[model samples]
Target chain A: MKSPLQYRILPLGDHALCIELGEIIDASINQQCIALFHQLKELAIPFIKDIIPAYASVTVVYDVAAIRKEHPSAYGFMKEKLEAMLLRIDTDQPLSHRKIEIPVCYDLSLGIDLQEMSQEKNIAVEEIIRIHTNKTYRVFMIGFLPGFAYMGSVDESIITARRAQPRTTVAAGSVGIAGEQTGIYPLDSPGGWNIIGQTPLKLFDAKRKQPVLLEAGDEIQFVAIDINEFNNYNLG
Target chain B: MSIQVIKQGIADSIQDNGRYGCQHLGINPNGVMDPVAAAAANLLVGNDLNEAVIEMHFPASVFLFKEQSMIAICGADLLAMINDVFVPVNTPIIIEKNCVLQFKKPLSGARAYLAVKGGFELQPWLGSFSTNTKAAAGGFEGRNLKKHDELNFRTVQKYGTALKNKDCEILNWKASVKNFYPASPVIRITRGSEFDWLTEDAKKRLQSDSFIISNQSDRMGYRMKGDALIIQNENQLISTGITKGTIQLLPDGQFIILMADHQTTGGYPKIAHVISADIPALAQMNAGEKIQFKLIEQQEAEDLLFEQQQQLLQLQNAISFPLLKFKQQYAID
Candidate 1:
């Protein structure tokens, strides 16, 4: 129960725990990763404060009092427990998958950078619209901001790097592309991603029962709407 | 009652202890930079620890009613004056209405705190009166006080006896202010989660090196320039909850120390976290001044924090305010 995979858990200062996941950024391994995450959730140690999952690694935070009971140093104790968990990985079982459809408005007024992106890609604006609405993108992780989902494996044709300088403000629900990753802005924050469109749907709402609309391992598809429909979409 | 902001030097805002327990909502706990000084100022004026106080960056002087009322100023010696007469720092003073308070250029330190009795009465948002300028929430209508804005205070009938003898006994009370603030720029820190990820050379530099605070700094985070701390393991980090004093390693190898208005979550590798007790020292640091970190064991850090808490409790008991005693008794009844 303690060991999950060949994960090297290193102690980060006194409060944080870092698990070095080598350097693989494949989306296929998330199934095993999420299953292990569920296992850890079930075991539920008291000292654990929070677990943050990224593309290839997960960092766990814990209290010192609960960590030092069995071991002398928090570093040694966390590493041992994590190494043990890695050894007992149940690879046969798969993680659960969730489907989340997001509503997007491809209007030129709302989608500030779509025309520019279409021009850069040398594709017609309608083709850019069709390709964007066509695929089901998998969420790789959530990072940068609260409820900000990193959904990716975008089409090679649409692959683009971030802007040279980040914009001072990217409106909330802005669907942007940075490198190969496509994500929706959960908050009105400064960002460098190339914005393609905007979603009327709230990616993250503090008032909602579940703040984040999509978690890691969820499948998503963007459905386009006209400007009138986007304007009428209930923000609340 | 509140004094109008005739001259808002550098930056001034109403802050309490801080707005905690809101990280999950992506809101940073915007509060006082030097909580020790803020709490001390509050103590001098017989206010609760969480009472709202004005945090003045550099110098802040105001024009208010000159009537006798308990007020305390702490942090940087901003050559403060009341009606052209010099007012001692750290000591609670009673002044008459129409007295003008002006702060000279800060001789030392970056910020100062002014706490009044009964605390400033302001509407709180999300259960806190703290102003988070980034989110544009809380404090004085969700922003800093402007010219001609007069804030009202919560009325308290119980006045400290020290209020009566403010003129004659001011010098002796000022001595009490020297105990908490030290002259040195050394701040104690606990090793961060990614401390080992740093190269041994970087780790040594961190221990022995002196850092200069950059000018492009704000309440959100302080960008510092020093020896680049290279991370040996260049793995991507997941975004997680970050607290005040969190030292994040940016992509450029620069150190960004999270302060009161830092982001709720971040993905950068946290190299170290300054102990909560030493944050006051960090708050006092001036831009371009040399600062160094003193490494301490986690246990020692925790112990120092507990000791500081004890000292605060002791200070609270030392006040001979009869009304405070009566109020405590009243609460019990």
Candidate 2:
């Protein structure tokens, strides 16, 4: 049997705690973190507000008043409860990730930085798109903006650095790459990622039951589509 | 029944206790910057503590009440007026129909909160009426109130019947303004996860050196210019969930304090987290203001938060009892 991972639970403030599972970003470590997140969610601990699963850790936010109503001390009660729950998590269980396929239009008109990135990598734009779509990526975390999923470990051949000067505003649905990771800008905001393509799907909608289309453990695949198909895809 | 916006001011939006349980989906908890002031305003109007309120900056929004209603204005003295009559903060005032409420200038803090008796009839997104403008979600149409925009109230009928005879009347009891703000605020903080990463000199300077808030500061964060803090080793932290009041040290050695509309996660080294009790004071800080940080124990921070909550509860009970009795009398008759 594989040995269980060691973790540290540190106080973020009076209302939150950070559980660090590992120091490095690895698939196994991420799985462990996600498992703990699911277990905590299942426990349905009162006063727990948000459970955020990231690259290698999970942060639990709670209401101190609600916790204090049940226990003499809020942090003390939470620490003891979480420590007990941590020991019961079964890391061997298979994690079920929702698979999602995103269609992207790689036409030069939409991808403003394609030519620049191509020149830096000494590769054709078509080959870069092919390399990007060929592999399945894991959703490491969802952050920077609402519904902006940070997916990872892109193909080495297409890797490029972030823009020297970030654009004042990156349009929503713009897919971009930075360092070893790739992500989609769910909203129009200032960003530093190198744009490679554009998608027509709405990644985030507050009206929907699930506001964010992607989650931390979901698997994502990018498929190249023609410019005409991209234009026809209904965003509404 | 509704209020129309005559002119929108800088950064005006509807906010409440904030959207919770959704930060995991990368949505920011964009709420009122000053929760204490927001709650006080709500209490004065006989509304729930988490009810949505209009938050405004200097030269705030000018609104016209289409119907008579009871409302309360709290936080920062924006020199508010009703049809040219001076209005005070932290008190419930009944306004006549068609009366225009305007904020002339800023005499004190940077932000002010306005609460209506029945609370604004806004559609809640993700369990909150707070506006998250970046995503164009929540609050009044996911945007700031614009000219000619109408906002309805939930209990307009009750308010109209209660004060039909008065052109304007201020409530007898008012929220105590003494402890609302301090002349020279000293924020309390606790060491963050990466606090040990800083050099001894840098750690010393963090407490001793004074920092000035930069003009670039907004609801997203407050950037401070002070002595550059040096770390023993140049290390990068994995992007993790960051909460409001997290003090992050940038690669250039400067610091940025995350605020109400802060991003869900950040990669910079988190040097400290301002305690919950002091976040309200920090939020009221204006650009070019100087601030100092004082380190406190974790237990001390918790105790301070508990005490503040207790005080708010007492205030709520004191204000709500009379309102409840009046409603009972009206029902009996």
Q: Taking the candidates in order, what DockQ does each have?
A: 0.23, 0.75
lDDT tens digits, residues B1-333, model 2? 999999988789999999998888899899999999999999987888999999999879999999877888988889999997898998888898898999988988888999988898878898899999987888999998789889998874444445546667676667875574556767888999999999999999898888999999999999999989988866667988889889999989999999999998888998999988888888888999999889998888877777777777788988887667755754512
Give the DockQ of candidate 2: 0.75
lDDT of 2 at B274: 91
Every candidate's CA RMSD? 5.3, 1.9
User: Model 1 interface RMSD, in angstroms?
Assistant: 4.6
- Residues A89-200, model 1: lDDT tens digits: 5833756688888888877877788788888889877787788778999887765666678788788888888999899999999999888789999889999998878988
Question: Cα lDDT for residue B49, model 2?
Answer: 91
- Model 2 error, position B296 (Å): 0.4
Off by over 4 Å in 2: B158-166, B324-333
Looking at candidate 2 chain B, the ten consecutive residues that score lowest on lDDT are B156-165
Clashes of 1: 16
